[model samples]
Target chain A: MLLTATLSLLLMQQAPSENVDWDAEFGVEEVERDPATGEIPVEPYEQNNENAGAKPFTGDDMAETFGGRDGIRQIAERFVEINFADPRIQGIFAGHDEVRLRRTIFEQFCYILNAGCDYTGRDMKSSHEGLGSRKADLNAIVENLQQAMREQDVPFAAQNRFLSKLAPMSRDVINR
Target chain B: MTPVFNHFATCLMVAPLALLPMSLCAQEVLSDTQSIDQAGTFPEYNAKLLLTNAVSAVDGASGGGISNWATIAGRQETRGVGVQAHVTAVLLPDFFYQSHGVALGIADRIELSYARQNFDTQDVGAALGIGQGYMLNQDVFGAKVRLFGDVVYGNTMVPQVAVGAQYKRSLDGAVASAVGAAHDEGVDVTLSATKLLLSHSVLVNTTARLTKANQNGLLGFGSVSDDSYAIQFEGAVAYQFSRRFVLGTEFRTKPDNLGLGEGDWFDVFAAYAPSDNLTVTAAYADLGSIATFTGQRGAFLQAQVAF
Candidate 1:
């Protein structure tokens, strides 16, 4: 009697719950019953591996997603246009000679493009000297540049690379 | 007894000299104290905003024109106590000068600064009638209080406003008083505001200052009452091109107090932060002249390190 009770407790622990209807849900076919005992065992389901695979991204795929450099240039041009409209900037470049001013703009773009060409324009001091430019004017220009970059969807990493090159000019640009 | 008395009197006379080294040592101790006091006054932001020293311009805000030259004033983030020392030198088109001094942050609310400016105008020749040339020297003592403002997190309603005053005095008493000028002493006051628009990635800083000083401690004499209370406006914008770098520009308009000239100032600049504690900045700047001078465009380089 003691042994039988111990076996019954062990079997109860290992048995499947009555709430689980495995045969009905999984559509398992009927199995032949043993002559001495009316019991059958069910097999585990097999997994399909044919469709579970990883693939590499190709160059053509990247082009299709980012739309390449041409798309980036268009975005840059729009940025310049919007930034030029700022009133503070309007005051700074207001009377500047068009030819020289255009050159300045072009040079900035060339540098951004990483074309490997010398800016060749006047150094920041010579360009702004005697102009009486102020901190407000500088802020406007920076805002416009940022706006332009944003419109182009330039990656944040690339934008920062450009900014790192530009930040040192502040000392020459203010309180002189 | 008579000789002994004489010896005692002599020792008494030498007592001051005997304590001279102790006094010097005391001064060194005072310097250290001043440094600690200055550091204690800055905002809690100093730990993360360590590069405020070298920039002099403090984010986008101007502390107080020539009177307030440090980037950030007071030591604490909001208010408590602190101290700072700054040295700046600029080589202009026609002149070169150096300015250096110390500032104390009190209650993390008010700040006091003293700076001496030494100017080398080179050769003025017969224009001033003094000699081949003469150098101009002056001292400026200034004070500022954070009336009602803050620049932390994303709060912008307060606008970080400050009011300040500066007193300038010249060393050349005769040259200064001879021109009907008031011994080269005057007071200047300003109201400043700074704000950051994080969504736009821009920082805008503005200042409106009133002054009666002449040549800003340059030129021969100080300001005449007739030209007192000149109004000046300055603004700057900085765009974070990346977490570690920013590009900015500035525009400032000044009063024509020198009777010598009139105009505005502007610049384009860029700043880089190699780490949270160090920042390097450069700019192309244009400063209208003291009087009839023009074409004073130039460049500047600055580095800031904070602890």
Candidate 2:
């Protein structure tokens, strides 16, 4: 009787291991941020400026109007900030790579505004895949971006000018 | 249902003899709301940007105060639906004009609208032997479909284009026949192109309308002498002062089919959106002469709500 009791206690102690996540145990890997770029590495594709989705302005006036590259960077950061905080669309963006978004968004803005930057990110279509975004979600993002631009003192007309460049991307960003 | 809505529906059901081929499927217009997600709450319906859906025109179509555009009413996007309702009044020196109606927008592709207009002849009614304070009522039912392009997106060089038709029925057949009208009902076909030049902060719309309407079908269709349709033009230019404020001017030509000397219409208007759901428009309108009363001008006021 004493031996049987001891064996049962030992079997119960080993039962907890049965619930272990076998997928992880089977060597599934979690993506890690690159030490150099501070962003999770992605499967690579050929990069092109056309991926920016818009042509840059011809003159430097538009760039200057946005307060140069630094201003563009700040605007991008604020835009992402508002997007992440906005409850209406946050669920769609919650799992996004914020570090990568800040840089790529800045690059897209800078390139489009003629502030001189190359976009190294994926195209709008691929980047927004599996996000389950709706038109209302897209509108929320636009509202947030507008708020960010307004905070950066972008003139309303200028803001709309910038918006016109981004508005066309909505078809790609929003789920059909 | 409100009496006004019941009346509007009644008018729609009773007027099946219109000149145009159309369907009666409209019951609402663009809704007023800034962002459906305001206050961090989930929205029941999609909400467009402030004033993006456009205000309710006097005719109940999606437009400014007096001119129709290529915009679809409702705060919904390409996959959602929306509705709006409006009440309007114009106090002319010699007459009083009132209109109310509803419109429905579907999937950003089609818009259906209905409006009832009442033109009180006031003292002019007595002079014309139609009894004092006689009112001329007209019911306008409209449908519009977007042919192609986007008003706020796509290639900036390509404006949004649409085709629409308004089937009008005059309720007072006796008064209309007495005025030498050939028919009590007519149709207006319109093609419109509209664009919002965000870079310039301007909105432009030009519409070509084919009609035989006398004072927008209040006095009825064409006259005994001529009952053919005439092509008229409607042009509007607006400046967006802010997200909620717009100032603009419009010009619309009218056909004097009855020889009532119903001249063209012009207005300088301002539209203000107080919230996502309410927009108020005030304008100085010059309707020219109506019937024989010359110098028909006045203040045009409209209030609209959409959801």
Candidate 3:
């Protein structure tokens, strides 16, 4: 009878339960009391907070992630370096030195980041103010952006989101 | 003394006789009709001339010849002002009727028009009437400006284009408002590029219209949803056999917004000028209608007189 009772108890323990045992032998630490407000404990940023259940921010992790400012900067740099050879851009920015090109790339990057910086480089209206660009020029810009995104392996979803925001501006930018 | 007097008179008479042939020769040379014909052919006029007198077909086809006749006449003499009143009465074999009123070329730049359409099918059958046959009417007032001229012929600087806008309002407000329309009034702006391809004997005109009006100023105003924009293309060619007559054809496309009409229309037209001021035009038009309504073809006639 004792052996059978013990076997029945072991079978019951194998069933699933809604309750979680934090004090089990799996190495999870248990807190006896909550930390006092305004008197926080000093812990490393990466350490998982037992009280707030938050993880730390790391620059290396940010560099690995393909979003936010760091990722945008990297993508912008690659795009400027690779697609600057496009004929459309060459025609529009003819006689522009490397410094001007770099400045334009930086302005684009800043605008994409929404970093609250003044993009003194002319808006679409002023940049194409009197240029009288045709539909071909607008299409060429879209193609160049697409190729740059593909070459840099920017995720498809991110690229689509950017294009949706950029597409409507074509009416203002292309006049011919 | 009497003999000397006779000699002096003879010398004077001989001198007068000698000059007569030279004067006659000069007059004959100067009075030739060739110079008069050349002057008559090329007269100087300051007003804009109409190189052609043709309507833009529904499919964006230009009628034969250079329809710029209207523009040319408007620009020729500053006092040469004219108004055209046109009423198109369309009778469908199925008993539907449409009518339009046009007051065009007022001030040589502004045009005002009104159109009304009725969809009646009682003569056909009861099955054609979904609920009640309605008479739809629209009022359109248009204003156009001749911003610049000689766009095609001038140095390749600016395109020969004209910009205009039409403001339309529907008469059946209750019915038009019930369809989730944007407003009772809609405005459509058009930029038309007209190029004279002289080598091809053709005028290729393309108009990009941003419009929210539903029925081309028919069915009253604001009957169409606001989410529609159309690009209409028209090409017209005229082979002139003589100075007074021309035969031509046109093809054009209109937007199908209300799902009550056919896709596009085409026409073959011939025009004759009986005099410098009077022009008569006749055309066979195929204007398709809504549904399986075939045989929507008809004939068109127009008379234009300019002073």
Which residue ranges in model 3 land beyond 4 Å of their true spot? A1-176, B1-80, B87-92, B95-135, B151-159, B174-184, B220-230, B291-295
lDDT of 3 at B4: 29
- Give one digit per residue, the lDDT tens place, for model 2 in A105-145: 99999999998899888888888878988767787788888
The alpha-carbon root-mean-square deviation between model 2 and the true structure, to one decimal in Å, is 13.6
lDDT of 2 by residue, B234-289 (tens): 99999988788999999998888887778999999999999888889999999999
- TM-scores for all candidates: the values are 0.49, 0.84, 0.42
* Chain A TM-score by candidate, in order: 0.50, 0.84, 0.51
lDDT of 1 at A30: 61
- Return the top candidate by lDDT: 2
Supply DockQ values for each candidate. Answer: 0.02, 0.24, 0.00
Q: Which ten residues in a row have the lowest lDDT in candidate 1 chain A?
A: A48-57
Give model 2's docking category.
Answer: acceptable
Over B20-87, each residue of candidate 3 has an lDDT whose tens digit, in order, gives: 43333233333433455654564333122233323422211122221211122122222334433333
* CA deviation > 4 Å runs, candidate 2: A1-18, A22-28, A129-134, B1-41
* TM-score attained by model 2: 0.84
- How do the candidates rank by TM-score, highest first? 2, 1, 3
CA lDDT, every model vs. true structure: 0.52, 0.83, 0.46
Question: Per-prediction TM-score of chain B?
Answer: 0.69, 0.85, 0.60
Over A108-160, each residue of candidate 1 has an lDDT whose tens digit, in order, gives 54443444223445556555677665443454465566566666665655543
